[model samples]
Structure formats: C-alpha cells, structure tokens
Target chain A: MEHHQSKSFPISHVIGFVVSLVLTFGAAGIALKTNLSFKVIMWIIGSLAVIQAGMQLFMFMHLREGEDGKTNLVNMIYAVFMVIVIVVGSIWVLTSGHAAH
Target chain B: MGIKWDEFFITGDPLILGSQIAILLTMIGAVAAITYLKKWKYLWTEWLTTVDHKKIGIMYIISAVLMFFRGGMDGLLMKAQTARPEMEFLNSQHYNEIFTTHGVIMILFMAMPFLIGLMNVVIPLQIGARDVAFPQLNALSFWLFFSGAMLFNISFVIGGSPDAGWTSYFPLAGKEFSPGIGNNFYAVALQIAGIGTLMTGINFIVTILKMRTKGMTLMKMPMFTWTTFVTSILIVAAFPIFTVALALMTFDRLYGTHFFTVSGGGMDMLWANLFWLWGHPEVYIVALPAFGIFSEVIATFSRKSLFGYKSMVFSILGIALLSMVVWVHHFYTMGSGPAVNSFFSITTMAIAIPTGVKMFNWLFTMRKGRIKITSAMLWALAFVPCFVIGGVTGVMLAMGAADYQYHNTLFLVAHFHYVLIPGVVFAVFAGLYYWWPKMFGFMLNEKIGKWHFWLFVIGFNVTFMPMFFLGLNGAVRRAYTYSAESGFAPLFMLSAIGSIILAAGFAVFCYNIYWSIRYADRNISSDPWDARTLEWSTASPVQFYNFAKLPEVKSLDPFWHMKKKNEGLTLFDSEIEEIHMPSNSWLPIYMGVIFGIAGFLLVFEWHIAAAVAAIGIFAGLIIRSFDYNEGFHVKKDEIHRIENAWRKTEGEVHDHVS
Candidate 1:
C-alpha cells in the first residue's frame, strides 16, 4: 500500500476519478431519465453527493497526506454532518405539513 | 439612482448634527495631533503597515471599546425617549434607527471583535508560538474589520442608519419596504466585516494546530487556546452561510433579483432560516471565547486548576455542535408547524445540559480553594448567577408553545441582555483587566476596577431585569412610548436611571485607564498573579518575537511546574538562532481603504464609481502576488540582548518577592 502511494501516477487516482464521473452522470441520468418521485430523486442525489465528497477528500484532496490527516478527516466529517442537518432540516420543515403550499 | 448632497448629509436632527460635528472635530484633532507630535512616520511604520499580532489585537480592542461607547449611547438615547409617558425626545423613525444601530454595533462591531482581539493576542503566547501561522493575513483581518466598521458607522451621518433592525429579516428589509440607501449599509458593510472574521477564524485554527511547542499536545494546551480553536471552527462553519445570505440580500436590493422578495417567487422565510442558521452559531462564536477567558481567570484567582478540564473541553465542543440546530427557535411563532418546532425546541433545550456542566465546573473549581477576590475574579463570580438567569429564561423561550406569548416582546430583549451582558460583556471586562499587564506592562488599579464592575453589573441588572416583568405585562419591543394609564412609565424610568449608572461605570473604567497609565507601577513581576498558563511565563508586555527559545512543555501547567521546580527560570536553555519575521507591507490598509470606498459607493447605488473602486481592490491582490519581500530577521545577538534583559528583571523581581 505504501509503495503504491509513492507512484508518479497512482492507479487509485485514475480509479477514483472514473468512479466520481460515473457517480455524477449516473445521478443526473436518474434524475432526468427516470420517472422517480421528488423524494426518491432527492435521496439519490444526496447520497451521491456524500459518496463523491468522501472520495474526493481522500483521493484528490490528500486528506490523509500529513501528520494532521486524522484531524482533517474529522473536520471534514463534522462539516458534512452540519451540511446534512441544515439542508435536510430546512427542506423538510419548509416543504411539509403546515409550511407546505 | 443617485442621492443629492442635501438629502445625503442627514440634515434634520440636532442630535445627529451634534455627532457629525464631533466626528469632524475628532478627525481634525487626530490628524493635527499626529502631525504636531512628529509621530506620523512612527505611527505609520508601527501601527498601520506592520503585521504584529499583539498590535493588531490592541487595535481591535480599541475599536471595540469605541464601538461599545457608540452602542451604549444609542441605548441611553432609546431609554431617554421612553423614560416618560408619550415622550417625544426622539420621534419613531429616529428611535427605529438608533435601536437598529445599537444591536448591530453591540454584537457585530463590539462583542465579536473584542473576543477576537483577545484571542489574537493570547493564543500565540499561551501555546508558545512566535506568531500566528499567517501574520500578514492577521493584519489584513484587522484592517478589513476596521474598514467595515467605519463603513457601518458612517451611515449614521452620510446615508442613514439601517432601520429594519440588525437581523435584517426579509420583506420588511426588501427594496419595496426600505427604498432608501439605509438598508444597503447592512448588505455591504456586514459582508466586509463577516469576511474578515472568517479569515481570522481560519488563521487561528491553523496557528493552534501547527504552531504549539514540542510536547504541548492538544490536551496539554491551555483552556483559552482550546476555546479559541473551537471558536475558529465555529467561525469557519457558520460565517459562509452569512456571506451567502448577505449576498442574496444585496442582489435582491441592488439588481432586483427575487431571492427574498415578497413577490417574484421569492421565499421570505428562507432569509429567516438562513439568518438563524448562521446567527445561532454566531452567538457561540462570541460566547465560547468568553467562557475560555473566564476559565483562565477563575483558575488563576482560585489557585486551583480548572475543575473537570476534560469535561470543560467536551462541553464547549458540545455547545458548538448544538448551537447550529437550535436556531429555528428564534422564529418559532412563524408557524413552521408543531413537528418542526418540536425538533428545534428539543435541540435547543438539549444545549442546557452541556452549559449546565460548564457552570458547575466553574463553581466547583472555586469550591474549597483559596479564592482571591480581585476585580477580574469579581467579574467572573458575578457572571455565574447572571448568566444562569439568562440561561433559564432562554429555556423558557425554547418551549415552542410558550414562545407565542413571548415573541417580539421585551422578555426576549431582557433574555438576550442577561445572556450577553454577563456572558460576553462582563467576561470582556474580566479579560481586559486580567490581560492588561500582559499587553501594556502595567496593572489597572484594583479599587477603580471594582468600582467599574459593581456599577456596571448592578446597573446592568437594574436596567434589564425589569424589562422581563414589563414584557410579561404586554410591553412589546420597538414601541417608542407608552401611555401613563398603561403603567409602564415607572419601570422604564427605573431602567433609564439604571442606564445612567451603567454609563457612569463605563466612564470610571475609561478614567481608570488614564489613571493607571500615569500612576501604576511598572516594576511588577511577569507572573504577578502566579498563574498556571504558559502566557504568564513571558515578560509583561511580551516581546515582538514572543519567546527567544520556546520553552519545553512537559505538562498542562508548564509554567507553574517550572516555577515550582525552580528550574528553567531563564526560559532560554536552548540555543538561539536568527528569528525570521514577516516584513511590513502597505497592501492591507490599501485594500481596506479601497474596499471601504467600494462599499460606500455601493450603498448609494453609484455603480460606476463602485465598479472603479472594486477594481482598486483587485489591484492590491495583483501587487501582493508580485511583491517579493518575504520578511526580515532578528539577529542572534539582538535576541541574546533582549532575552538577558528580561531574565535579569525576572531574577530581580523574584528576589524582591522572596
């Protein structure tokens, strides 16, 4: 694992990049191509976003590159938590029950 | 699209006219004094262009104090206007403007910077770092905040103060309702200041994480540094939401986009949701640091280590996490439905658990300890009961069902003041008193400081406490006056009297500064309080390069251990090398001035001039990218000389004390 990371052009980056692209276009395709409900579409997109973000951080951003790697990863996770709480909570409250049009 | 000269100048009110003259005279006086004293070059080189964190902290503090005075005067004016039945000291519009400016300045301009200022000064030394990770960026942060504050302040005389209140909620603050340039200051000035605060947050986080001395692991670090670290995290996470919110506001007002418009497919409640999303954490941004300062002071004066140190750290982190979810309570009455409100209400009340832990930690730290009752200690002591009152009322407001009765009333007003005055303001006073010697090499008078504390705390309670009863009696906020038959006359009169006493307390505090400069002894020891933190290990009024040789940290209370062992007294056991420091540059103030001009122009809808000024801001970035001045160095000999002088004084003071 250590030797593989020291490569000039790692296989992991290529695999990560390809996976990220597939995830992005796949989510878009499911949204535009499918006849899914809004709730299902949102769920798919949100889960895709989380996967892509995690992949990017570890692969592209080198979140595990330094002595502060654990800290950086923890911070990223906490930030993701805040984003999920705020976005999902706001949408849920605003679009349902008494707040609904 | 333009304002005429007569309408632009704020011509009518005599009170505003008086302040206009005062501003003019103060400017002219400052310029004349700088020139007459032949200190223009010195001031420019030392203060304006340099990237020293200590100097920047002093500048932040000075501005916070001045803004405090301005905000306090606004308070006095509002109180005076409502002192009697149907009083006409200020008409309703002017009253609206004053209260709006009061809230904005007190929170954004005053409390935020005051805490940030303390964090900037103390964090480096406490962790044994030479300076912040990015010194030049720190200087830029100070200038940006300064320029933004100036832009907000000038609205009083030039355009007009924002009258839709500091929260700047939508539909009320939209162009349709507030068509004048007044609300524009809110959109532009806060954007500038908010950006600066976000940068400060990032700077301190990197500093604490990367710059601590060897063996000073995360848990070994001081409480103040821990608080700063957490506060910086809060700032990074929370401030971006505000920046986006303000930009949406700017677009809705300036370019006629409908992000928050009443018509045009806009959702007004989106602004409220976003505002509180950022706004709730903004409370902890100021508050967590105050808790840190109180921890340091309480531990020092109590002659005991902070009780439950690990628990204190966890509780602060817990508060930061909880602060984000609880914001919907700010507008429970907006009818987001029982389910939504219940979710928020439970999260809001959950905050009390961690806060209660912290309160118990402070009290337990003092129990059975040899507590010295100094001015700083008094402030910390007073904060306990006072902040508890605030917290209990907050829990009362947290109940979604009961909030319908308390919304938009003086009860809300009283709740915040109880929290802020004790939690933020009193803590700032305690910190200033505690750290004054570290900043200036002299002590504040204990007698005078006590007088400042007593009058302020008593007057603070007298003013805000009655507002709760009045709020329960159906006194709504933002009402300019009350009828005598309605029976709010006497309580308001009492609150007005309390404000006068509070003003007197502030006056005494200022006078103490002047008096101490003249009379306080300069020969005191570095560790006059015999404190346990690494900050007290350095000489008073710390050196520019904070330590010659960074002390080796072995424990949480490294300095106290070193003192007890009677070893490492010189703190220069290691060899000295040439110290590299960042070079002073003109780019920061240049960007601050030019960006402020852009903000001013944008406020008045001068698109052409504003665009031109906006270009000047980018020009600063261009110049900086090309500039090759990395920094200068303090030679080994210079370090030796400075370190020896400090050690000699330390030896003499220890001898004298013994």
Candidate 2:
C-alpha cells in the first residue's frame, strides 16, 4: 500500500487507461454488432458511463488519498445526487404531469 | 456604433436631470479634493494596488457602504412614490427604474460584497493564516467587483437604468421590450462581478483547507471559518450557473439570440430555472456567513463555547445542500403541476429542520451562560426572532396549493425582507461591531451603537409588518400607485413613514461610525471582549503579517484553552522569523479598468471597440500569469521590533486595566 501511494511510474495510469479502453470498445461493439433493443443498449452504455466516471474519480483524481478523502468522496456523491435530482427531476416534471403541454 | 444619442444622454425628467447633475458635481468635487491634497499616488500605492487582505477588505466595505447609500436612496424615492394615491413624486418609468436598481444594488453590490469583505478580513485571522491562499487574486476580485459596481452605477446618469426588474426576466428583458442599453449593463456588470466573486470563493476554500494552523482539524475550526468554508462551496457551485445564465441573457439581448425570447425556439421558463438555480444558493452564500458571525458573537458575549458545534457545522452544510434543491419553489406557480410543486414543497420545507437546529444551538449556547448585552450581541439576538418570522412565512409559502394566493403579493415582499433584512443585514451589522476593533484599532461607541440598533430594528419592523396586511388586502408590488378606493392608502402611508425612519436609523449608524472614529479610545487591549477566537489573540489593527509566530492549535477555541491553562498565550518564547508577503502589482487595476470599458462598450453595441478592450484584459491576465515577482519578506529584525512594541503595548494596557 505504501509503494502504491508513490506514483513514480505509470503502472496505475496504464491499468486505468486499459480498463477505460475495454469498457468503451465493449459498449461500442454491443451497440454496432448486437441486435439488442434500444433500451437495453442504452442501459449497457449508461452503466459503462458510470463505471468510467468512477474510474476517473478514483484513479485519476485520487478521491481517497488524504485526510479529506472521505469528506471529498461523500461530497462528490452528494453533488451527483443533487445534479440528478435537478436535471432528472426537471425533465420529468417538465415533460409530464400538468405541464403546459 | 449603434448608439442613440438621445437615449444615451438620459434627458427629459427634471428629477433625473437634477440627480445627474448632483452626481457629476460630487465626482468633480471628489477628484478636485484628491488632486488638491496630492493624494492620488498615496491612494494608488496604499489602496488601489495593495494585496493585503485587510486593506482590500476595507476597500470593499467602503464601496459597499457607498452602494448602500445609493440603493437606500432608490428605496426612499420608491416609497415616496407610493406613499399616497396618485402621487407624482416619480412617474411610472422612473419608479420602475428606481426599484430595479434598488434590488440589484442592494443584493449584489451591498449585501454580497459587504459579507465578502468581512470574510476576507476575518477568515485569514481566524484560521491563523498570514493571508488568503492567493492574495493578488483577492485584490483582483475586489477591483473587478468595484469596477462592475461603478459601471452599473453610471447607468442612472448615462443611458438609462434597467426597467424590466432586477430579475430581468424573459420577453420583457429582451431587445424588443428594453431597446436601450440598460438591461445590457445588468448582464455585463453582473458577469464581471460574478467572476470576481467566484475567484474569491475558490481562493478562500483553498486558504481554509490548506492554510490552517497546526493541529486545527476541520472539527476544531471556529464557527465563522466553518461558515466561510461552506459559503465558499456554495459560491463555487452556484455562481457558475449564474455566469451561464447571465451570458445567455446577454447573447439574447445583444446578439438577438432566442435563448429566452418568446418566439423562435426560445423558452422563457429556461431563464427562470437557470436564474433561480443560482439565485437560491446565492441567498445562502450571503446567509451562511451571517450564521457563522452570529455563532461567534453569541459564544463570545455569552461566555460559553458554542453548544452542539458539530451539529452547527452539519446544519450549515445541510442548508448549503438544501439551498440548491429549493430554487423551484420560487416559481411554483409556473405550471409544472402538483407533482413538481409537491416535490419542491417538501424539499423546501425540509430545509427548515436544519435551520431550526442552528437556531436552537444558538439558544442553548446562550442558556445558563453570562450573556453580555453588547451591540453585536443585540444584533445577534434580534436576528433570531426576526429570521424565525421570515422562516415560518417561508414554510407557509412553501405549500404549493396555498402559494397561488400569496404569490407576487406584498406578503411575498414582506416575507423576503424579513429574511434578508434580519438575516443578512442584521448579521452584517453584528459582524461590523464585533470585528470593529480588529479592523480598526478602537471600539465603536456602545451607547451610539445601541441607538443605531434599536432604531434600525424598530424601523425595520415598522416598514415590513404592514406589508403583510396590505398584501392580504389585494395590494400588489411594482405598482406606482393604487386608487384611493383600493383602501391601501393608510398602510402604504404607514410603510413609507417607516422607510423614512429606517433611513434615519441608517443615518445614525453612519454617524456612530464617524463619532466613534473621532473619540473612541485607542489604548484599549487586544482582547476587549475576552473572546475565545484566534483573531482576538492578535493585536487590534493587526500587523501586516497577521501573526509574528504562527500559533500551535491544541483544541477548539485554542486561545481560550491557552488562557485557561496559562500556557503559550503569548509567543515571547518563540523566535521571530522573516515573513514572506505578496508584492503589490498594478495588473489587477489595469484589468479591472479594461473589463469595465469593455462592458460599457458592449452595452452600446460597439462590438469592435469592446473586442479591443477585451484583448487588453487578456493581455493583463497573460502578464500576471508569467510574472515572477513572488513577493518580499519582512526581515527577522523588523519582526523582532514589531513584536517587542506589541508586547510593550500589551503590558501598558494590562497595567492600565488592572
């Protein structure tokens, strides 16, 4: 764990890059070659997107590195929750219910 | 070159013409006085280019006070206009402009910068940091805000003031409706200031996070520091939305884009959503700091450590988070239906719980403790009950079904004033009085401060309480006058009288400052209040380098603990060292001027000239980016001398008191 904390080489970066590549190509291949329904394709791609974001947050940003790591992680999760509530909630309410349309 | 000379000159109204003349004369007089005194260089070196957070904070306070005067005058004129039925004190357009400027200047210029000023001055000292993380950037923030304010202020005498409203909502704010450069000033000025505020947010966050004294954990930080941290987060998250919203509005108004136009694929509600998305959090950006200030004042005066310190921190964070989600409640009647309104209603009401927790914490802190009735504590005490009234009415308005009846009425007006005046305004006064000795070297006159407090509180209640009744009796806002038969005459008259009284209260407060500065004793000790915070551990009118030796924090209220244990209270045992301070530069002022020029030119549709000025701004930025003048340092001998003098004075003060 102590050795891993030192970024004197590119091993972690390479691993993160390779994993991101596989996820991206896997989703693209499913969309292009597979005859899955549109909803199913969207689900797969969306899950892939979430995984990519997590990778970026953990591997690149080092969300859990210092004393503030836990606070940072919690705040990020809370921020995501708020964004979802705002964007998804706005779209849901605006497109349905007693909206003007 | 699309300027219309007639509209640009802003002629026709005698009242406006008189005011324009008065403003011009004032400007000339100020310049002449400065020139006669040969103080231009002194002003430039000491103030305009200084990177000291304390000096910058003083500049912010002065500018914000001037703006408060301007906004207050606007308020008085509006009240006079509506004092009686068919009053002709101001015409419809003039009334519209006054109220619009009043709202914009009061909130953005007066309240926002006033609080930010206090934060800049106090936060660094509280956390035992030498200065903010980026001292030069802090100076840049102040200059930008000042330039924006100056540009917006000139709108009254030149061109015209924005008449659509402070919100500058769609269609009405579009070019077809407001063809002049008024709304353009609103967009460009706010954009400039908003950018400044955003930099300040980022600056303080980095400072508080990375610059704390040793052993001062997040949980061990002062309440003001905690509040500043959370407020900074809110600023970072919320200001960008405003930046985008204002930019879109600018494009729509100037370039004829349809982002919020009624026709051509434009959606009006998008502006509302984006505006409030930022606007709601902007309230807490001003408010949470007030909460922090109250916590400090309450604990100091009550002679107790803050009760439920962890809970207070959580409540502040909770309010910050909740502030974002509750923006939709502002426009619940915008026809998003029960599903949307109910969701927002619940979230809006949920905010009250955290806020209530904070109120109770303050109460419990004061309980069974020695409570000093200082002016600062008086303001804090007044804030509790007044803010509760505002909060309760807020919950009432949060009910989706009931809001239809209360929306856009004087009741809405009353509710917000209750929140803002008591919450933000009272807190600023409390902070000013509490931190007066630190900022200056002397205390404010307590007797005069009491006069300022009582008059302002009574005047505030008198001004706003009647609006609730009048609003219930079918009185609407933004109306210049109502018919005599509408039966709002008595209440309107009463409210206008209350405004005059409020103006008097403000006048007394200003006078108190003048009197105190002239006569207040300067030989007072550093710790006048026997306060528990770290800031109080320093000398009054703190040195250029805040602390000669950085304190080692062992617990919460570190100073109090040091005093109680009679250990390490003074740094006489520690060796003095050279202190590095950021060098002052003229780049920020240059950038501010160019930005202001660009903004003014854009308001007149001089795109080419504006573009050139914009390039100059970027050039200033580029110079700043490459500049290698890191700073200068106070020599060890100089530090030793300053520290010796401070100790001598401390000894004298202790002798005189004992």
Candidate 3:
C-alpha cells in the first residue's frame, strides 16, 4: 500500500510569525524597561504591527492567490498611503506653528 | 447606577413639552392610519421585515421622501424668518434649530437614504445578481437609517433640535457650552445612522467584490455599479472616523470626559478634523451616484455607449481617493498656516481634474447620438452646466486666499446648494423618472414631468445664484435674520422669492407623481427605454426573485446587444433550479426600535434602563440569529407558468400594435 503524504506548512510563514512575535515582545519590553525614549518604542511597535498585518494578509488571508491579487494589493497600498498622508499631514501641519512648549 | 428619572424631569422645558406632544400625536395618527388601512400585517411582512433588496430600497425611498417634506418645511421656515428685515416670526434660537435640522435632514435623512435606496434597488439588477450579498444585513441597515431619521425628527418635540450647525463644531457643541438635550440628539442620531451607513458600505463592498455574475469583470461593470463600489469604499473608510468623533462627543456630554472641550485638556480642532475627514468623502458619496445617474441617462437617451467609460470609472475612484485629503480646505480660516492650507488647496484643485474628465465624458456622450430630451435626460443636461459652475466654484473656494472671502458666507451656501440641488438631488430625480417605469410598470406623465424639470431647474438657479452675489457682497451665513440697513435685504428677499418658486416646482412634481400613478398606462413594456443593462431584460415591476432565469451576459451592453443580434432573444434556459433566498425576520425592525428607544432614554439621561434595554435587544438579536428558517423557492414549473402568462400578454399587445 502506498503511503499518502500530508502537506506541510511553509517554513517562510513560520519564520515570519516568529519574527513578528519577537518584534512585538521586544518593543513592549523596551517600553517597559527603559527610561530611554518611549516614542521610539511606540514607533517600532507600530511598524511591527503594520508588518504583521501585511504578513497575515498575504499568508493567511490568501490575498495573493487570486487573479486580481496584484490589483487588490495595489489598491490597498494606495489606500494606506492616502490614509497616512491625510492623518499624519493633518497633525503635522496643525501643530507645526502652534505647539506649546 | 440606576435610572435617573428625577434628573430627566429637571432637564425638561415647555418648548420641548409642546413638541413632544405634537410628535406623540403624529405617531398615534400614523399608527391609526396603518391600522385603518388594514396594512399592519402587510407592513410587517413585506416592508418592515423584508430582506429583499428591492423592497428595502423602496422603503428607504419612502422614508427619505417623508423626511424630505419635514426637511423642506424646515427650509421654508428658515426662508420665512429671513424674508423680511428684523422678522420676528421666529426667534433666533428657533431659526438656528430650523436651519440645523434642515441641513441634517437634507444630507443624512433625505440625500443619503435616497442614494442608498437607488443603489439597493438598482445595483444587483444592473450587475445581473439575484440579490445583494447578506440580504438580512441590508434590511438591518435600512432600519438603522430609519431609526436615526426618526430620532432626529423626534428631537424637535422631545427637547429641541440640534442648534449647532449640522457640522456640530465644538466649543459651541461641547458640554459646557451646549448644556441641552439637542446636541445629545445630534450625537445619538448620527451614531445610529452612521452605523447603518457603515453596514451598507460593507454590504455593497462584499456584493460588488464577490457576487458579480460570471463574465461581469470590473471594467465591464456598469458605471452605476462602479459608483456604488467606490461609494461603499468611501463609506467603510470614512464613516468609522465619524463614528469615533461622535462617540467622543457622546462621552464628553454624558460622562464629563473631555475629548473636544478646550479647557478640559481637549482640542476642538480635533472634532473639526474628524468631522471633515468624513464630511469631504461624504460629498463624493452623494455626488458619485449622481454622476453615475447622469452617465446612464445620457447614454440611454443619446443612443450611445457612455463615452470614456474607463476614464469615468478611474475618475470616480480618483475623486474618492482625493476627497479625504481635501477636508482641511473646509477650515482654511482655522489658521492652519500657508503650508498646510497650500497642500489642501492643491489637493482640492487636483480633484477638479477628475471631475472635469467626468464633465467632458457626459458632454461627449451627448455629442453625436440621437438625443431624446426626456425629463430625465433634461435633468442630466441641466446638471452639466449647473454642476460645472458648482465644481468651478468649488475649486475657487479651494484656493486658501480666495476661501478667506468666501468662508461662512452665503457664497459657500450657494456653491454647495448648487452642487447638492442640481448635482445630487436632480440626479436622484432623474433616476426616479428613468427607473419608475421599471419599478412600477408605468410611465410618469411627460407633460407634467417637463413642467417639473424646467420649473425646478430655473427656480433652483434663481434661488441659489443670488447667494453667491450676497456672499461676495459680505453677507454671512447662519444668520437668523438680517437688517434692512445691512444692504443685504434685497438679495435676501430675492432668495426668499426664489425659494417660493422652488417650492412651487416641488409641488408640481408631487402632483405629477400622484396623477401619473392614478391615470397612466398600467402595462409598460419591460424594456421601455431599450436600455443596455440586465435590469431591462426582466419583467416590469420585477418579480420577487428578480430574474426568473439568470441572464447570460455576452458584452457590456448585454441586453441591447442581444436584442440587436438575436431579435430580442434571451439565453435564459427554461429549466430553472430552485432559487434560495433570505427569509424575512422582525429582528431588524425590533432592533431599530430598541435603539430608537435607547437613544431617547439616553438623550434624557435615563441611562441605566436604556443600557438594560439595549443589552436585552442585542441578546434578542443573537438568539434570533440562531433560529434559522430556510426560505421557500419558486420551482421551475412555477417560473414557466408565470413567464408564459407574461409572454402571452406581451404577444397580444405586440399584435394589437402591429
């Protein structure tokens, strides 16, 4: 009788998940432990969260599997860029001249 | 925490007392009428609990029409108060309430519902789908919207309408400044409506993305469907920001938390940012559908395919994308500095390019084809010039320096009314005329329709055009009454007269609708306009399941192309399988009622009871969801029986005509 082989999970996905977890924990740990800049910790955490979201989207949501995957990805990126520009730019411009010391 | 019945009584005023009585009476009357007409069961089964998109859409339109009358009455009140100098007909506070309610109702209750209703009715049909994805959610969304509208109107009687502008700018709207139930009503009403809008957005996105028929690619989708998709996206991304803003405002009002209170370590500007973030996209959410309506009307009447279809689609998406960045343009007077202002100004100006592309697309659509200037087509044509002027002025106002002069002036009012009235409202009217035949198996009276169109267009321009001059001449907006010595009285009088004309036009339209429904030909042909979409391929007054047999699309103008090639042939197979549809449920309406009651209680500070009720209602919804009842389907033989009857009638008519 022939033995049927079960499919294995991709090594890259495991690596990506592990890295995301480490980064998340590291950022939290740094914020908790250090008198050094907390803002830097927040930025690192935020970036890590964004990356994790992307990884999950691609690896889990199967965003890149369909015929329209490239188009959908591009549209999402554009939307994200627009969002960042609006939110960040609004804050920067509103505060640039009027920030109290 | 217990129910604060004593505190609720303390907040009461006589004005509120009076209005409450009036609202109660109206509700009683409505209930009595429903009972008298023997429509209780029918309303419950067909309208309130219906998961059918077309039925839900019709209900939405009915709700919006009712709200339009309420909002229009508010507008007339404002006009009446402002008509004469030092007019003591209404107090300043009353006038403020009137205008605020008008703005709120017109945008939220009237325009949004109307557009959404049109989309719900038409998008699935156009895309060759049986119904929208998540039909039950669609019903819930409509109920949510209805509940919000009900809450908003109820504010007039219960306490007072929101006195702050529809924008509800803070400092004025904050708890310290606005210590009343009015602002609470605004917050809760919008919160409820905003949820509905958000759900609708998600529903449409899912439907458009996942439920299009085979061969109906994105590029090949109708312009209206494209607009629906983009508008849904706008709703998903933008409405959440509004929800957050409203939630914060609610917290500030109810819990003494400081989100927008300036002295309480909160920023008023944050409210402005959040509101405008949603506000700007909201303009496109309304306008894009209007654009789509024009595209369809122009193409069908002109006997041509929509010119620059790809560009038009891209332009809609572009506009949706750009709308978010340009919110700051609304507040150039806030001292955002030249750099910030310039960035917003340039972005706002950039939007004009895509809008311009759309304009040219419409004009070219009418350039060389056999144009039939029906009432709907006339509205589309009138929209061209009216919306162009509005769009141009929009760009003008986008210039930071120019906006300084225009901001908070009647000019800004004129510009928006120009766009909203002729652009959004007229497009809605045109769509109603165009699709009435399909929805109701009868044509509206062309003679009466023409009267409505011409009178409306002329009166609209007359009413709003002078406001531009008034703004330029230094007249401010939101004033309850102006003095004769202020040199603004003549223009104000002119505007008031123009408003009367516009009201007259609306009256004519109402009359036409009434008359046409009573006396017009009952047997309207299925493809009355010989249009392109899948909707025209179905029976007039589309059956409950919509398509008896699913249509096979061969090209962009599937119905039109098929008719030309195969001599009015359909590829729908006679052998139809059992079609599964969603069953009607009372949960959505019940949920809406619970929310409405909770809102009323919260607005009056009856928090504990309201919270209990809310939890109970949600629990009921969850329990109801577990009770799955499979919907019945029309079998193949039943479909054939219905189709053969329709065919025989059609054949008899054709023979008589020939």
TM-score of chain B of each: 0.98, 0.98, 0.95
User: What TM-scores do the predictions have?
Assistant: 0.93, 0.91, 0.90
Each prediction's DockQ against the real complex: 0.27, 0.24, 0.18
Cα RMSD for candidate 3? 4.8
Question: Per-residue alpha-carbon lDDT of model 1 for B508-613, expressed as tens digits?
Answer: 9999999999999998877778788888777788889988878789887887777777655654535788888888888889988998999999988889989999
Candidates ranked by lDDT, best first? 1, 2, 3
Which candidate do you rate higher for lDDT, 1 or 2?
1
C-alpha-based local distance difference test score of model 3:
0.84
Check candidate 1 and list the clashing pairs: none
Superposed by TM-score, candidate 2 places the C-alpha of residue B638 at a distance from the truth, in angstroms, of 1.0
**In candidate 3, what are the lDDT values of residues B1-658, reduced to their tens digit?**
5543454432355655665576779889999999999999998888889999999998898898888888888888887888888998888888888889999999999999999999999999998888999888898899889998998887776566789999999999987878888899999999998899999999999999888877788888888999989999889888988999999999999989888898997888889988988899999999988888889889999989999999998899889889888898989888877888888899999999999999999899899999998999999989989988898899899999889989999999999998899878999999999998877878889899999888888888878898899999988899987878888888788888888888888888899989998999987677777687878777778777887666777678777776666534432554467776778888888888888888887877678878977896778678775666666677777777766656556532223211
| Residue B61 local lDDT, model 1 | 97
Tens-digit per-residue lDDT, B236-278, candidate 2 = 8889889999999999988888888878677888788888889
Error of 1 at B120 (Å): 0.9
Backbone collisions counted per model: 0, 0, 1
Model 1 over residues A1-101: C-alpha lDDT tens digits? 11222426577788889999999999999978999998999899989988998898778877777677677778778977988877887887677656687
The residue-level lDDT of candidate 2 at A57 comes to 71
Please list the residue runs of candidate 2 whose C-alpha ends up more than 4 Å from where it truly belongs after superposition: A1-72, A97-100, B650-658
Give the candidate number with the greatest lDDT: 1
